[model samples]
Target: MKKFLGALALALALISPVAANPIIIPGDKNQRLIANNLYLTTDSLFAAYMSENLEQRRLAEMYVIGVIASSEGESWCGFKIASPDAVQEQVYIGLKSASEKLPKSRPAAAIKSRLKEILPCKK
Candidate 1:
């Protein structure tokens, strides 16, 4: 009985991490929704060009900065932002607009689409 219990504990330990970290494929709707929830919650705090939730805003800014850095020198999102500050402003504005017009829209996707529309790649 002790051996069986030890085996069960080992099995659970092996499975716990896998269960905690579910695979999220790119472009998956559910994955997008989950990712957007984080941004949307933070973006919602923006009021009159400032965020009411500074901590959340800081986190969102970091996330947007990372995305911008990753997209540098590429037309991945078809945006030609000239500066990091510009990119941050655009992302926040895009997120705010998305939250107003399409409250349930995925933020990353929405911001990408918005950037493509307003700041299309100049080729």
Candidate 2:
């Protein structure tokens, strides 16, 4: 058991990832890009999110920041909040609680974030 533990610890140390600066961007209930300048502010972003294609949404974010020429699959969607350090945690929560007007879309789905991956866009 001691040898196993030592090997596991060594493996973990060797595989550990280098951390980057943490950034959180506000997203709507649909987890789409609601920011006008950052994204087109279209239903497509929402639809892609509904389809669970979070990759697309992330791509859109990357486009906003010029990090990528265009949004492709699973790429980070670089959205800039109105100002630096302006983290609106409520925006996503409010959007989740609000009733939806879109037709036939399964009732309002809550937008949530997972900590491990930083897609920036969360739903």
The lDDT of each candidate is 0.50, 0.32
lDDT of 1 by residue, 6-113 (tens): 567545644543223122122333344244334343234233124444554564555555655565445244334446566666777787787677755555565566
Candidate 1 regions exceeding 4 Å error are: 1-50, 73-81
Q: What would you estimate as the lDDT of candidate 2? A: 0.32
| Collision pairs in model 2 | 58-76, 58-77, 61-77, 61-78, 62-77, 62-78
In the range 12-97, model 2's lDDT, one tens digit per residue, is 53454311101112233434433323322223323333333456546433432332223212233333422312222322332233
- Best model per lDDT: 1
Q: In model 2, which regions exceed 4 Å deviation?
A: 1-42, 60-89, 94-123
The TM-score between candidate 2 and the true structure equals 0.21
In candidate 1, clashing pairs total 0
